[model samples]
Target: MNHETKRDVFEGLVEELANAYIALDGEGIGEELTNEEKQAYMKDYDAALPDDLPVIPELIGKYLIMRKHDRGDLVQALDEGTSFLLDGTQWESVQDWFWFSDVKDSVDTFARAWVLGVWRVEETGEIVKLEEEK
Candidate 1:
């Protein structure tokens, strides 16, 4: 796939993941939330996600590999420059590297930090802690 196509796919995946997270967060409190309250919550959640996230090539490659594994579509992933399909060793390697690596840890950390109003600097990718409102 081209760079633009990859970016679109990555963005769609991010949106899907964010919506799922929002839905999961609201699960038990759904009944208590008014329409305006839910809208505000969604707005906040959207704002928490960085709009200027650079499309990290490694992350996008891993995402495509995961999608190929899940959907059994080797051709598409290979077309996008993934080497092997999810065979035994390749599957284990992909799982270990993608799911258990520092990349995942960083993502988890970012999400946790975002909940506390910390954000990443788009240009430098530095983590900044936001001051709490009185």
Candidate 2:
């Protein structure tokens, strides 16, 4: 995607995350939230849904339409040019990743990659490649 679209997608993702968090917070499933707080959170969340908020419906469903395949977020959400299609694809980003038997599968070490960003696979090895907004 072009920089403009990528920028839009990135911003959209931020909003999407905010809405999700707000909903979860509004649920007040934790013991920390007071009744008033829950009410206030829900009030704001509901009020924004129908507002002039930009809802990228395509993203509202699924950001990528590519065929089913392995996917993950790794340690955190990746930015532009970091994530790509297919499993183990990210290993290509790491020069020495081939040393590990399952570089594409998991990283037991607390690794850091300046170019690819820092991450370690907790359960299973994944490229953490999710489809980008195309």
Candidate 3:
């Protein structure tokens, strides 16, 4: 999807999740949910969409691409540039994957690859580099 489309989808997912959390018990209480529960909630939340989400395995591909670049493997990086994750949310140094700066900016490479991003909705999603951001 294009930048605006992706942003809209992302925002829509967030809003839908919020609505689902609120509507679940009709008490507007938010609770910790597993990634699976969250996605399932989204499907029911946005009944029009019918639970069409990318599989979590896609994140592995993005991680591998980032790992190649992190290791100074330019050729591999270039080959995978078209479909890699490189937002501040996913990687720390464009070449390195870091979970986030919340923990003294220390990187747990394994965690980075496994946990996805700062935001749950965009966890396994690709980064959309818009012209303004670039």
Candidate 4:
């Protein structure tokens, strides 16, 4: 699927999951949920999501490496040393590069990188570069 379509699907899935979670009861799996339980669950979920979540485009399930092109930047080399994976909610290092030791800073920090390529799996289960698919 195209990036936009994939993004839409992913967002729909997230909404569905959130709704399902909210509908679940605190006691039995199928019982009616209390308002307190729903509130608590929503609080935790909202806390986990980043404040800048909307700025994150449809990069879910993508693996990538980015390099800064600006020549005047002194930390360019360090920025290019690690690969990253964006799993909907957060950005994580694919390698042990220690760039994002603080979980809160990882997503916003990675967003600043100049993306070299995005790798995603096809419907047939083969992984390919997004550019090559075009």
Question: Which run of 10 residues does model 1 get worst, by summed lDDT?
Answer: 1-10
Off by over 4 Å in 2: 1-4, 25-134
Clashes of each: 0, 2, 0, 0
Compared with the true structure, what per-residue lDDT tens digits does model 2 show for residues 1-134?
11123345445646755766666755553234567866755555443321211221121112122222224342332222133434333323222332333434223221222112212233442223223335
Local distance difference test values of all predictions, in order: 0.44, 0.32, 0.41, 0.39
Q: Compared with the true structure, what per-residue lDDT tens digits does model 3 show for residues 36-93? A: 9778655644433212222223344455445543663434443443344344334323
The candidate 3 region of ten consecutive residues with least summed lDDT is 48-57
Better of 1 and 3 by lDDT: 1
On lDDT, the leading prediction is: 1
**Cα deviation of 119, candidate 3, in Å:** 26
Give all TM-scores, in the order shown.
0.21, 0.18, 0.19, 0.21
Cα RMSDs, all models: 17.5, 16.6, 13.5, 14.9
Model 1 regions more than 4 Å off:
1-92, 104-134
lDDT, candidate 4, 64-106, per-residue tens: 3323222323254345435443444444443332343434444
Candidate 4 structure, TM-score to reference: 0.21
Residue 25 error for model 4, in Å? Answer: 14
Residue pairs in candidate 1 whose N, alpha carbon or C atoms collide under 3 angstroms: none
Q: State the displacement of the C-alpha of residue 54, model 1, in Å, after optimal TM-score superposition.
A: 7.8
